[model samples]
Target: MSEHNTHIEEHRDDEASKLGMWLFIFTELLLFGGLFLVYSIFRLQYPANFHESSLELSVTIGVINTIALLFSSMTIAFAVTAVQKKNNKLALRMIGITLLMALVFLVNKYFEWGHKFEHGLYPGSDLMQLLERGHHLYFSLYFFMTGLHALHIIVGMILLIIVYFKVKNGSIHHEKYVFMENGALYWHLVDLIWIFLFPLLYLIS
Candidate 1:
């Protein structure tokens, strides 16, 4: 009887934790959505400069990072599915692939930003001093939005690392995968944000 009650309690806890994660995700959506609204308002106020700054960005790198993030999202989804099916090996591989892809995206971002620095486009640079206010505002938004999103990606990777260790230790298996699911959900959110960000900050430019 005690064992049965413990099982029931565990199930309830899983449900509660999942609900909590969803609430957190909703909060994240609102946070990014508000930033998007700001971006739109500023873009409207400085359409030409925004377009020009957008054009200066490397579409190639943006597209590549987009592809990398999308692929990572898929791998993490597969990892979650694998864990649900009790296929531990496949789950670990999928998570590893997801991590690798995330690293690739970050490396590309590093080079892209470095290229910008080489051209002296960062805030407070002499180049920025020469540019119009609209350009400054555009780059400011660009840095803030992308930097924040990148920070999320790093955080997601850290969470995945913890999940990976849990899986290794048999703590996150088919019968107890709520944590894995939450991690995957967070990663998917990261990918979703990049989807919107790429087009808005790169293609539209």
Candidate 2:
């Protein structure tokens, strides 16, 4: 029957959408995995150097950024929940809050990075000055890894902005919130990366 054909087509469309999202997520994981592998190899090769370089990082600033990212993740989660409840206003508010938190996180990172640059600790430039003293390799990886992560955070914020508008304009609804959900998932991935990065780059002995 034509009715049965229509139902089947709709189901296929839904399944395809979900599959696409999962594929995107998997690719993101692999991208980050490559960076993690590099970090692990370098850390293993220069444990002492890494530890010493890590000490130069501002623990307080890192902690604050961590808290900001965690709060943003929470806000995004709430936004997703609000959309599920069909409360567009609350969802928009939550997304706005998440965006604010993301901005705060980026600002803190800017200062942290600026402080390092002031000390001539930038990657590939004055890195030799620190490595010459024995253990600046860690700083190299720190900047490379954390710098890449910060870029991802910026990307996540942009995605959130898009999702906010989509939800606000009623393009996303309770029954059709796949885009918003996927966007939240991506944002959470960014936060999760920072969670691991904080400990690896700043907390490890």
How high is the CA lDDT of each candidate model?
0.92, 0.84
Candidate 1's displacement at residue 197, Å, is 0.2
Runs of candidate 1 exceeding 4 Å displacement: 1-12
- Please provide TM-scores, in order, for all candidate models, with all chains considered together: 0.93, 0.88
Q: What does the lDDT come to for candidate 2?
A: 0.84
Q: Give the TM-score comparing model 2 with the true structure, all chains together.
A: 0.88
- How many angstroms is residue 26 displaced in model 2 relative to the true structure, after the best TM-score fit? 1.7
Residue 37 local lDDT, model 1? 98
Best by lDDT: 1
In the range 61-130, model 2's lDDT, one tens digit per residue, is: 9899999999999999999999999999999999999999989998998999898788776876655564
Q: State residue 43's C-alpha deviation in candidate 2, in Å.
A: 1.8
Candidate 2: where is the Cα deviation over 4 Å?
1-12, 127-130
lDDT of 1: 0.92
